[model samples]
Target: MSLENELKSLIIAELKLVDIKAEDINDDQPLFGEGLGLDSLDAVELVVLLQRHYKIETKDLEQSKEVFASVRSLANYIRAQQDRK
Candidate 1:
């Protein structure tokens, strides 16, 4: 599957979201606040999702800021990591 579709699936499955599709998410849309209505718990879940999906280890808070900026960033990171492996 494409990165977009894979991410959509991963987000829905990992976050236990309902009635959402890939098209529902904007690439640069904020994952928190009014964008996705995600909270700290959702952020934690997203961390787990990144670990499982990207196979990348992110420890620093600053690094996470860039990596998990949005779905596009996350997917790009995942693709890069997957390529490395």
Candidate 2:
């Protein structure tokens, strides 16, 4: 599967988003606010999800904002990090 789709699955599974499915998520859809209705706590869970699954560590707050913007962005970030390794 595509990284974006994989990320969507991971996000939904890790965050326990019982109301949503991977197919329901859009690549460019916002993860927070009105998009997926994610909150700060979900952001924290996302961080843990990245580390646990992708071995990624997002330490910069500003960068995290961009990295966590959407499923596409998260997939890009994961790919970039993997490329570095």
Candidate 3:
């Protein structure tokens, strides 16, 4: 699967978002607030998901904010990290 799709799936599964489907998420749609109805706890789960699944460390608060913006942003961040390796 594409990275965005994969990230969507991870978000749904990890967050236990029972009503959401991977295909239902838009790449540019915000993961929090009005877009997915996610809250701060969801953000924490996403951080763990990224670290566990992709080994993407997001310990920096400001950087984590940008990385968790959307599926596309997370995918780009993962890709960029992979490139650096």
Candidate 4:
């Protein structure tokens, strides 16, 4: 499976977002107010998930918003950070 698919699966499984599926998450969807409707706590969970799954660390609040934009964005960021390491 693709990284985005894996990411979507992880996010759903880890975050327990019952209603949304991988395909429901658009590549450029906003994960906050107007899109997936995730809150700040969910964002924290995303950060923890990324660190645990991808072994990349990030703590910047604003940067987290961009990185957690969507599954595709998170996957791409993980791939890029992994490559840099």
Task: Give per-residue lDDT, candidate 3, residue 27.
Answer: 99
lDDT of 2: 0.91
What tens-digit string does per-residue lDDT give for candidate 2 at 1-85? 9988888888877888897889999999999999999999999999999999888999999999999999989989999999999
- Global lDDT scores for all candidate models: 0.80, 0.91, 0.89, 0.83
lDDT of 4 by residue, 1-85 (tens): 9888888788788889997888888777777888888898888888899888878999777887678887777878898998898
Please tell me which predicted candidate would have the highest lDDT against the true structure.
2
Candidates 1 and 3, the one with greater TM-score: 3
Assess every candidate by TM-score: 0.82, 0.95, 0.94, 0.88
Instruction: Give the alpha carbon lDDT tens digit for every residue of 2-59 in model 1.
Output: 7867787788788888888878888888777877777889878888877776667778
Shift in Å, residue 31, candidate 4: 1.3
| Stretches > 4 Å off in candidate 2 | none
Q: Per-residue error at 50 for model 4, in Å?
A: 0.5
Could you give candidate 3's per-residue lDDT for residues 1-85 as a string of tens digits?
A: 8989888888888889987799999999998889888999898888888889988888899998898899999999999999998
Q: State residue 57's C-alpha deviation in candidate 3, in Å.
A: 0.6
Q: Name the better of 3 and 4 by lDDT.
A: 3
| Model 4 vs. true fold: TM | 0.88
What's the lDDT of the predicted structure labeled candidate 4?
0.83
